[model samples]
Target: MIELLVIPANQSQRRPNWLRVKLPVGKEYASVRGLVDTHKLHTICESGNCPNMGECWGAGTATFMILGNICTRSCSFCAVSTGRPLAVDLDEPNRVANSIKLMSVKHAVITSVDRDDLKDGGSIIWAETIRAVRRESPATTMETLIPDFRGIWDNLYRVCEERPEMISHNIETVRRLTKQVRVQAKYDRSMEALHRISEFGLRTKSGIMLGLGETEPDVIETMQDLANTGVHVLTIGQYLQPSKNHHPVMDWIHPDQFAKYKEIGQQMGFKYVESGPLVRSSYHAEKHLFDQVV
Candidate 1:
């Protein structure tokens, strides 16, 4: 058996103050829960163990996970379950769209796990989901964070066909660490995915995680590469190991470093950069649609 190596248990693994997350609560939060439960929709908030689930749910926004909770890829950095995913639920698109309508969300975020088992990489569903949301909630702007589609342009074209306000494909980490961190995903392919999205004149976005033993220059170089691809927005966040079985946190990055990365990203000509210990791909994503940053 090929045994996986994990970081040793140490005091450094203890989360710092900057990483503290608020517990889910409040009336709006409960209402959102009702929508999620009643409609039987899956969300990245739960699957990805997002830190801002409380804050975002309290504000009546969420990143909906489509296809299924299970992923096709077994990336070391992701917490989403891997193995054989259940058959695709064809009705999920309208369910998610109607849920967004019921919530009266102003800006919606949608994402899906890699479904390489499917012929289209689940891109057809991705496109239909966007169309459903647009039809159900005409006033709601949207951001669609997507998989690499294993670099299939035809499948990618189906997604871009909807012309969502923004399209995000996370590089997840620096180039040198891509093999270990993102496993099945390639650094250049992800960049190319963003480049293709940019070609459509849609607002292109991508995010990278730190604390994976990546160097400062690696980040800067990644930013430069993303800029060259015409990516307009960027997000940087500290990587927290999902569990002992997953990838280990290499080092605890300071808040100041995140701040510096934000500055560096802005200097690189990105329209906006969300960098902080608690930031995630869709953190404060609603604001991204308005060209506003919090």
Candidate 2:
């Protein structure tokens, strides 16, 4: 067993000092909270138990979760609920768009649960949500962190047609752990999805979580895989186990190692790499809107 995993389990379930985050506070966070509640909108920040919810919501940026909260696939590392989702809410796109409008979000990040139950894999709603956001807030840039649509290229094409400022699909773990971590998601399909997205000429991005027992070589190979797909941006974050029921954290990667990975990703030709203990898929996401490293 890896030292970080065995040590933490043996010592009791306490996170390292660096992982501590300020409790969600501030007027801006309160305002964003009210708007989400008012619009009955779902955000990955809340659903996925994102550690940076406080910081992101405080800054008035949110990654909206569309379709519904219930996901079809039960990825072991995720906190989102799994089951048959609610009937597709036709009006959800408008509500999300209106909420972004109310918040005056300059760059909106939209995501959804995997609705594999739907024939089109929820791509219709995906495209519609992008259109609605574009129409409601023309100036607001968008980053859609999307599902793989079960490798149905047509569904993927539907989303690309909208051409959000950036489109991201997370290959949540390395290929070796994909079967264990992501249950129903296939590593090859995800790479193909990103490759197809890159072929569309849109700014492409993807994220992966560390600490699932992935080796440095696994991480580097994953980075190379993503880069081969023309992924313009990459996000690397520590994988904090969502609950005791979820997959146990295999290792708590040190910040220095995270920094080293970021440097390696830069050398691998990624336009940008966000790697840190507390980083999540959409953490500081707005900065990835351009191809240039900021």
Candidate 3:
């Protein structure tokens, strides 16, 4: 049997400053939650248990997770469910578009669970969702955090034809720890996905999680690799184990370390960098890229 590596229980615990969060009780937060519930939409905030859910919801923005809640690949660090996914919700695209319109979201982020069971890995639905959002809110900028489509170039081509404002596929971790951290994903394959998306002239982006037993050199190397793919935006966040059954965190990288990573990422030619303890791939994503374009 493969021996499970163990780390300290508190390895992922944040300091007092890092534990700050506002409760989801305000009027704006409740209103946003109501809209999601009314449309039967799934936001990454609730599904992925993101730390910034309350804040993002209160701000009337959210990251929508489409396809289905059940992911085919079981990444140890993620909180999303892993199982045979349900059939594609045919009405999901319209619902998501309606929700975005209701929320008056100026910039929207859509992501999905890995649906390997599907022939095109749910790329058709991704394209439909993007188009739906565009049709409903013509001025809203759309961003998609997509799966690699398992290296199916045709599937990716279909999604790219929608012309999203940005396309992101996360590397998730450094090359050395990729197998242990992202068991079902390939480092090279992820790089290829980023490269392929960039080739289409879209704003390509990718992300990686730190504190998963990766060294500083490894982090830099990963950034260099992503930059080499012609990716325009990069996000770096500290990995926090979602449960005891999940992988243990290797370290709780300080906020200053994340700031330094941002500096290095900018110097490496990333058009936008969102690196910090609380940073997720879609966290404040629109603000970062929008600020640059404006």
User: Which candidate tops lDDT?
Assistant: 2
Clashes of each: 0, 0, 0
Model 2 vs. true fold: TM: 0.92
Q: Which 10 successive residues of model 2 have the least lDDT summed?
A: 1-10
- lDDT tens readout by residue for model 2, 42-130: 66677676788878887757888889889999999988899989999999899898988987777789998899999999999999999
Candidate lDDT scores, in order, read 0.85, 0.87, 0.83
Q: Candidate 1, residues 24-127: lDDT per residue as tens digits? A: 88988888878778877667786677779878887767778889878989999888899899999999899899878887777789988899999999998999
TM-score of 3: 0.90
Provide the TM-score for each candidate, comma-separated: 0.91, 0.92, 0.90
Best by TM-score: 2
Off by over 4 Å in 3: 1-16, 24-30, 37-40, 290-294
